[model samples]
Target: MSLFPIFLKLTGRPCVVIGAGRLAESKIESLRAAEAAITVIAPRAIDAIAERADAGELILRARPYVEGDLAGAFLVVAATDDPAVNRAVFAEATASGVLCNAVDDPPFCDFYFPSVVRRGDLQLAISTAGNSPALAQQLRKELNEQLPLDLGDWLADLGNLRREVVTAEPLNESRRLLLHQLAQRHVCAYDQCPSRLLAREHARTNPIPMEKA
Candidate 1:
């Protein structure tokens, strides 16, 4: 299925998960990582979940999923092992126009969690469109190994330099070429030093004029 992939910022927003097992625990962790305020509804929860609830990390309702639980939720995850309960949760979420994800059920999910690799502020996500989650996870691991640990820092530096270049000079073919050259030359340097400073000095020396010869 063709899906429009989009990244969401859920910091401090309300999210609900209708299960307390391993799957629900995983979803809760992911939401917490995103800084979402999460509430879990299940008849019983694992020790970790119970602890989080007790610690006020999340709101845990030690009861079965109810129809009104979908109210005021920004996102919903139906992770119960019981198909009937999962279906009910999906239906309530759909009726409320909230985004829903039913674990292992693509048709019932409005969104699917991707396998992610996070480094500092850099995040890389991989998904198989809910087809093969294991493969997606494997690819994420492979990419984590292949990518350099310092790449994120380098990228952040390059991004700042790009913004400066764009603001310092108007957009034109010559300016574009200069930025491209600079990016290609310094995009691999993670540690900022006199070498990078010298490189920038040299790059600024020869600005190609936009006028045709």
Candidate 2:
């Protein structure tokens, strides 16, 4: 069966990471970037992870995994070195109906963390279905170089214009086509103001006709 692709809303949501090694640290960083409230469980934390905990970046619980640790969590990550512990966490997550990721174990994971590239509010995720994470990381690096830093800002501007157009105009096939074309054209442009204005003018000029009663 194919794994389903999902984008979760983690802002202000509780996320539990059951490990404190390098892999767990990476997961914590990613979750922090998404503004998730993170709680990490580990008997021994590495220097970097300890520093983050000391700096008040994440909440660290210096204890072993317990049964109710997965309770009230929106998401969980199992990155321990022990395969048995990881499997146990996965089972608990499944029983609780919480999304879980067992690092480097595709069979045990409900979701796999993808190598990601972030530019402001824009994010690109690349996954290999656990077949080759190295390849995914390499592709993400290549994409990082290809994507301009200003693209995120441009995308945000286009999004705002799209919302305005959708609200101001009637929903019709012609309007939808025009909007799609405008979005595609402006997304690739460096300067968005002119393109946005042109789109608005085009929409104004081609108003949807009302049928006679």
Candidate 3:
């Protein structure tokens, strides 16, 4: 299947999880990291989930999920061990037009959770289209080992420099090319960086028209 990858902003958005076992707990934690407003419905929960509930991190309804449990939810995770319960939740979410993931049951899922490698604000996600999660996880491990821990910090500095350059430079092909060149060079946000100094000199010498700059 062809999947369209995306990054979602889940802050303050309502999300539901239909179980509270270990698998479900992982999903809940990921949602929590995104600052989603979470509600978990299960007849029983593991200690960690219960503690989070008591701590007011999320709403816990210690009962079997009933109809309307997914009301107003942006997404639902059917993480129950029982296939019937997971299917039921998926059906309800489908009818309500909410995204659903029936854990480990790829055919019933509207989305699959990917194995991710994170470094500060940088995230690399890998998926095998539900074909092989193990392979995706292997790839994630390889990438984590290869990527530098400080890459995200450097990216942040590059982003800030780009913003400043865009504001000061002219709107032309030369300026556009310079931005790409700057990205290729090992340059920091400092004014003394060789690439930045060269760019500044170039801008001074080849000034664009006032209306275009």
Candidate 4:
């Protein structure tokens, strides 16, 4: 992939948005999901954006874009109706070494937002490298339907069992196998899981607590 894909920790980090229209509202929502400290700049905004500001979800500048609005920002979104405004936000953000996305303008964007399927902590992101966002959204919809709604709960349970196996088994191979089996619990025939017995046997044989992940 030309673009390196990685999840970022943006919680409480400073972020700036240059618009408050519909497109900008979507961008702000994405930032809010990551718990970023967002500041929106626009003379007028849609009711949703204004409501968010009133709710203290984000700060509203109530003005047009300024030359140094991008300073001290970790990331910026330029989603104004004016192309010139978007480009200006990108230029300022770039000069200040901050990552910026100029909405639908690929050349002005440092990164593109992916179509995401979020199930608790499990997030699957799909991108077409800005070629077709509609296709990405379509795939996301399909995956959301196929993936089990309670998959996150199952994963959490499996995690607890895997940690127990790590403490119980002396050899890495045995622990690995036990963890692997626990992962395959969903495929167990009938109502009983054969791997649970094996995991317990190993724990009974070697009772040693270990560090947790």
Candidate 5:
């Protein structure tokens, strides 16, 4: 089946995780990395999860899963080893219209967590539609090795230039093409760089009319 890939903005969103073992701990950490407001439900939690709760990084409920646990959650993760409990969580999540991922149980999951490689603001995610997470992880490792560590920093510079160009230029095909060319050829916005010089020349020669500005 084809998947519609997306990057969610989970900052300040409410997310629920069921179970607190080693597996649950990983899911919780991934949610936390996205700055989601997380609540973990489990009768027993691993040391890492307990410590995080102690530090007020997340809300922890020292209890087993219960009905209504997923209410109002934007997303839910069922990370328990118990297949019954995972299915139960998935049912409630489906009824409530919340996205749910039952780790390792694709049939009960609304989504699967992709293996990710992150560098600053850049993220590369690999997914195999829950068929083979190991393969996704292997691909992530390979891409991580091939990509330059400084690529994110260079993208940041390109972003700044794009913003400036948008503000200073008008809507036109030349402007659009110039932006694409800049991305392909520019490293950073160093004034001495050939690409940067070309950008400066374009802006200077094709200034927006006074009325348009």
Candidate 6:
């Protein structure tokens, strides 16, 4: 599948999950991490899902899903054990023009959840186009081990450096070279980056000369 991968901002957006089993719990947790306004529908939920409901993390409709459960939902996840129920959800979501993912069923899915390696804001997602989830997970594990832990902080620093250059430097090539040079110090082992300060100083001192157009 030639999927166009994207990271969606689901904060405060409505999301519906059509199951409350262990698999659904995993999907729900990922949604929670993205701060989506989640509504779960199932006749019964597992302990972890029940706990989340009790803690007010999500809204739980403790009953079998009805036809309109996905109404006005931005995204839907059908993680129920029953294939029939999952297919029904996929159909309804498709008809309503909502993005849907039927867990473990690639043909029924509009999207597939990738195995993710996260270090704070730095997240690396690995997907095998739903062809091999196990392979994706293995790749995530390998990347997790190889990638440095302080990468997120490094990225934040680099971002600040980039903004500084963009504000101070008028020449596009000068800004590009500075950004590329900063990218070379990736795979950060330490959180403290003295280069960020130096970069700011460089931006201030070496102002891009104006072109005599």
By TM-score, the best candidate is 5
Whichever of 1 and 2 has more lDDT, that candidate is 2
The TM-scores of all predictions, comma-separated, are 0.79, 0.84, 0.87, 0.85, 0.92, 0.88
The per-candidate count of clashes, in order, stands at: 0, 0, 0, 0, 0, 0
lDDT of each: 0.83, 0.85, 0.90, 0.86, 0.90, 0.86
Model 5 lDDT-worst window of ten: 186-195
Higher-scoring candidate on TM-score, 1 or 3: 3
- Candidate 4 lDDT tens digits, 111-205: 99999998777899999999899999999999999999988776666666666677566666666666776787752222345565667887786
For candidate 2, lDDT tens digit of each residue in 17-90?
A: 99999999889889988899889999999998888889987889999998889999999999999999999999
- Give the C-alpha miss distance for residue 56 in model 6, angstroms: 1.4
Pairing residues by index, what is the TM-score of model 1? 0.79
Give the local distance difference test score of model 4.
0.86
TM-score between model 2 and native: 0.84
Where does candidate 2 stray beyond 4 Å?
A: 187-192, 206-213
* Candidate 6 stretches greater than 4 Å from native: 186-193, 206-213
When summed lDDT is taken over every stretch of 10 residues in candidate 6, the lowest stretch is: 186-195
- Which has the better lDDT: candidate 3, or candidate 4? 3
lDDT of 4 at 116: 94
Candidate 1: lDDT of 64? 96
| Weakest 10 consecutive residues of candidate 3 by summed lDDT | 200-209
Which 10 successive residues of model 4 have the least lDDT summed?
Answer: 186-195
Any runs in candidate 3 off by more than 4 Å, and if so which? Answer: 187-191, 195-213
Clashes of 4: 0
lDDT (10s digit) by residue, model 5, range 1-213: 899899999999999999999999988988999999999999999999999999999999999999899988999999988999999999999999999999888899888899999877889989998778889999999999999898888888888788878887887999999999988965575678776677778888789989999
Give the runs in model 4 whose Cα sits over 4 Å from its true position. Answer: 163-171, 186-201, 207-213
